[model samples]
Target: MAPKTIIQQESLLQYQCELGEGSLWDAVRQRLYFVDILGCKIFTYEPSTGKHGYQSFDRNVTALALLEDNTGLLAALQDGLAFISFDQLPFPPTNSPSTYKRLNVDITHLEGFNRFNEACVDPSGKRWIVGTMMHEQGFPGSAGGGLYSISKSGDGLTAELLLDQLTVSNGMGWTKYNKTMYFTDSLRKEIGKYDYDIDTGAVSNKVIFSNVDDEELGVPDGMCQDDQYGIWSARWGSGKVIRFTPQGEIDLIVHLPQALNVTSCIFGGPNLDELYVTSAREGTTAEQIKRHPSNGDLFVVKGLGFRGKERTRFQGSFLA
Candidate 1:
């Protein structure tokens, strides 16, 4: 067995978050975005100018994706999806009533403790795939969560349920060719691979791509793929971001010593050679928090000698 390559990480932002997830890189704007689910905040940071800001909301803002044509951002709130124009939001954002244009998608079926989780855009930028999870932790197969794909249908938006019975539908990404798709069900402790059809926005031939049987290594949370077909998955409780080969083999692990609950990661920076990671301090004990003071801070891993493809933006139309 080849030895696992270990890499060190550095803190990028000291802004504390209860549950910092949904790492995204807007290549066109050269900025990074992420969300604090429990904090109800969406943060933005420009690497070039060191200008960091955030927009707070009354409800949980779990995930975000850039919109095509630079219209704005597609945000996954607690109940449903919405559109937020960054140009309209103030710099050094305030906790004003969220200025998002809520999309007309019926999510009342996901009542009770269920809420939106991770979301991503298809490689072609034609569809938005978002997942749901129960607010409280439930056993595998116990939670009635699901994954859905949203697209523009004529003048309005339509949502198609793709997968159901998920405990925690988390990260998702596509291959460079858009022929393969990867998704993570955190409580299942595995990542699934599927045959992807970009034209039809469908996934089939689902199979377990990687399974983390060791509890100490933590479950797979959020992930992004590289140009070389490596899946970089953030391990929730292990303070590690692992890189798995296309064949489901571990090739590299990036360690963030101060972050025990690593949430998500994405590639950014001028050359796209850097990896930006988000962490959580939500479920930590007082002692654990004391030990890892920067548990909820964002971090970056550099000098990996590899890069990722630019993420696609949501091309769907917004509600008037």
Candidate 2:
């Protein structure tokens, strides 16, 4: 096996965020879009100009995916999934939802599902999201809480049980070749891979792909895949991310400077060789908050590679 490594180049600067979690690579706009749920904000990183822009949300802005058109966004707002524009999202690039009531209809009913933890779009355009019962990695699962999905149409969304119980449903990635779907229930210390049926967006035949039993080292959180089929999982308590393959093969692990609960990672920079990471500090003590000053910050490492396509929302499969 190849040894663990870090990419050595950076084309942009690291920015501190309050609770940075989701890291979406916007291929159309050539920017890194992420959210700080506890801070209730959205951030846009423009590498070309070194400009970091932000928008504050009313509740939590959990996850974000760019529409196929490249100019809009599919936001997993605290209220629900909204065809939103942050600057002016729904339509007209000017009309915005003023109240949680007027926000995405789906969320209006499921706001209680969770603050919306992590999500990914399937090949059919359905939005698959997990409501973190615990919300935070180490916390316990909320009763009756689990996974959910919003159909491709503009109408109905459904809450289903991917698992009866879960703490943080974070790691989600399509395989390098797009044949498998890997998901992590962070507190379970288990990473699972399911047989993915792209045509129907159904997942089944799940088998454990990796298991990290050390509570002190933390369980798995968000992750990304590379062309070599490497699964780099961010360990929520260990202050490191590890690599595994689709068949449950261990590859390597890269350590971070502190255990601020690494949240998610993605390959975004030019050439898809730079790995960007998101960290969190929502539950830290005052002392911990000070010791790991980079907590809830954005970090990057050079010299890694991935072949992931920005996923598409079926409705907006308008092809950007």
- Candidate with top TM-score is 1
* lDDT by residue for model 2 (273-292), tens: 66778888776788986666
Off by over 4 Å in 1: 92-97, 107-113, 135-142
Give the per-residue lDDT digits (tens) of candidate 1, residues 115-187.
8889998888888999988656554435667888888877667888787767788989877688988999898
How much is 128 displaced in model 2, in angstroms? 4.2
CA RMSD of all predictions: 2.0, 4.6
* TM-score of candidate 2 relative to the true fold: 0.81
Number of clashing pairs per prediction, in order: 0, 5
The true-versus-predicted C-alpha distance at residue 149 of model 2, in Å, is 2.5
lDDT of each: 0.84, 0.64
TM-score of 1: 0.93
What C-alpha lDDT, on a 0 to 100 scale, does residue 161 get in candidate 1? 79
Top candidate when judged by lDDT against the true structure:
1
Worst 10 residues of 1 by lDDT: 105-114
